[model samples]
Target: MQSVAEFDNVGLRYGTDAETLSDISFKLFPGSFYFLTGPSGAGKTSLLKLLYLAHRPSRGAIHMFGQDIVTMPRARLPGFRRRIGVVFQDFRLVPHLSAFDNIALPLRIAGIAERDLLGPVGEMLSWIGLTERADARPATLSGGEQQRVAIARAVIGRPELLVADEPTGNVDPDMAVRLLQLFAALNRLGTTVVVATHDIHLLQEIEGAQMVRLDKGRLSDPTGSLKYPPRPLVLRS
Candidate 1:
């Protein structure tokens, strides 16, 4: 199977005294569903930030789409980012933009035709049960609604990889399950999914999932079913 992303002995330090992530290594395969769980301040956010190219590793290498991200040109980062979609913890929607515009941003950025944008954007909004609220601003929507809108926007382009940070944090349990099912559906269609969350009870109920637990900036394969050796610990400077 082709690998979508790999972290090789990656470590991250925010400042002189803090080690955000240490000795971290993992390979996310194409069409895989992964749940990243850990306590708060355990580097889950940092890991997601690294995965999204928000921050580079303090040491070691991160390979995405067959290239070393650390060595990639800064001018090309945005193009690389377009290949992956991110649903942030904050639901970073443009408050001034309507839900439609917000979800259409990716396509618009790519210079997609105006005629072609409505189909995918509308379908995604409907899939998330937000078709009725498509004209509303983010500030007017409920937390769960905003979360769903954020998700719609992320998967609107059907990215090769989807990285969601604390995706279900604001959603009710029933809706959380629903959202997870949405992700599962996307994975079935061949998009690699990596979700960072601390919702153990919710994730454990997901069958056939590859659960990666991070503790003290270290990673583990909970099922131990993979033939590959365990990912090594990433050390912080």
Candidate 2:
């Protein structure tokens, strides 16, 4: 089976500054769950930016969904990004849109009929336990509520790849675990999940999840798993 994404000696720099990420290489396979861990200023966010196509690396290659995204035409990026979902640390929800609309944005962008959206959107609202807050705008929700809405928005489309940055940072331990379970559930359904987090406890939440650690912009594979091709994963309950 084809890998969902592959990074070959990837390096990223901003302007004339030193590379924010260097010699980073990894492969994320379909149905696999990965935990990206590091201390503060460890280039976690920069690497995630590269993963989500928010920025191109200064050097090295990145292939996703079987295509070289670095050289892909800019005009084509929006279409490609639709296949990937991202949950930002900032919970970038639209201020003007209510929770339900924010979660439904992707489907609407894909041209799903208005009638077809209510079921999925409603189910996602229910899943996040925000059904009562569906009409609330981002400003009206608490940080945790906003975070859940952001998560629900990201996964509602069920993209092939899901990338999250410090996804559980703002929630209590129980909510954090619940969010991880949501990601695990998505992974079980075959979405490749990569979560960049500083929380080490989350690493053990999903059995068989691979780990990739970063420090000062360099990659380290403590488990030595990144060197080989990934096998089909069977996540344990």
Candidate 3:
């Protein structure tokens, strides 16, 4: 199988703290669905940051489309990033932009004309089930609605790679199912999807979705799995 991205013994660190991620090695196969899971303080977000080229790995190598990202010319990073979509955990919606406009921003950046934006952006809002909220600003919408807008924006452009950080955290169970279905549909169409999440229950929601558990700072399986592992003991004697 072909790989879209590869990380060889990747490690990342903050200013003076210990490495946030260590010895992370994996190949992201083209057109696959991956769920990155771990407890708080785990390196899920850090890993995603590396995936989307937000932060370079502190050590080891990362290759996207067979090019070494660490050594890639800084001027070319935007071109690489244009081939990927990211749904930030923070929801990062522009405070003043309406939901529809926020979802349309990516296309606009890609040079789509304002007059031609309605079809796809409208469809995205409908998929987000927030057509009524289309004109509402992020500050006016509920958390879940804002999240939907963020997701709608991320997936609308249908980039080759989609990296979502805790995408379903703000939504309800049913809406979560809907969002997972949306991702699955996108995956089937050849978009590689990696979702970073803390909700283990989502592991069962998407069939054949590969689960990569980050313990402390290492991957549970380099190949990864969807099956649930034994739950950690929490009750005190």
Candidate 4:
């Protein structure tokens, strides 16, 4: 099976600054789960930006869904981005839109009919335990609620690849585990999941999740297993 994404000798720099990411290389296979862990300035967010097509690398190649994204025309990025879901650490919900609308945004952007959105959107609202708060705007929701909304929004589209930056940072431990389980469930359904987090305890929540660590803008895998084919996750009963 074709890998969902591959990076070859990737490096990224901002303006005249030294590279924020250097010599990064990895492959993310379909249906696999990955955790990107590193210190605060380890370039995890920068790497994720590249993964979700938010920024093009200053050097090296990035291929997603079998296409070279670095050289792909900027005009076509929106179409490619539709195939990936991103959950930003800031929650980035539209202030003017209610939680339901925020979760429904992707489907609307995909041009799904208005009549067809109620079912999926409603289900997602329920899944996040926010069905009663569906009409509440981001400002009205608590941090954890907003985070849950963001997660629901990211996964509601069921994109082929899901990239999240510090998804569990704001929640309590229980909610964090619940969110991880949500991602695990999505992974079980064949969506490639990549989560960048500082919480080491969450690493064991999903069996067979490959770990990729970054420090001072460099990649390192002590186990040397990240570059190999993904292992199947053994879900606990």
Clashing residue pairs for model 3: none
Give the whole-model CA lDDT for all candidates, comma-separated: 0.84, 0.89, 0.86, 0.92
Q: TM-score for all predictions?
A: 0.92, 0.95, 0.92, 0.97
Backbone clash total, candidate 2: 0
Residue 62 CA displacement from its true place in model 3, Å: 0.5
Per-residue CA lDDT of candidate 4, range 1-237, in tens? 688999999999999999999999888889999999999999999999999999999999999999999999999999989999999999999999999999999999999999999999999899889999999999999999999999999999999999999999998888888888888889989999999999988887877888989999999986565668778885442
Per-residue lDDT of 128-147 in model 2, one digit per residue for the tens? 89999999999999999999
**Residues 125-186 of candidate 1: C-alpha lDDT, one tens digit per residue:** 88888899899999999999999889888988888899999999999987788888878777
Q: Residue 107 error for model 1, in Å?
A: 1.2
Q: State each candidate's clash count.
A: 5, 0, 0, 0
lDDT winner between candidates 1 and 4: 4
Lowest lDDT 10-residue stretch of candidate 3: 228-237
After superposition, candidate 1 runs with Cα above 4 Å error:
225-237
Residue 174 miss distance in model 1 (angstroms):
2.3
User: How big is the positional error of residue 178 in model 1, measured in Å on the Cα after superposition?
Assistant: 1.7
**What ordering of candidates by lDDT runs from best to worst?**
4, 2, 3, 1
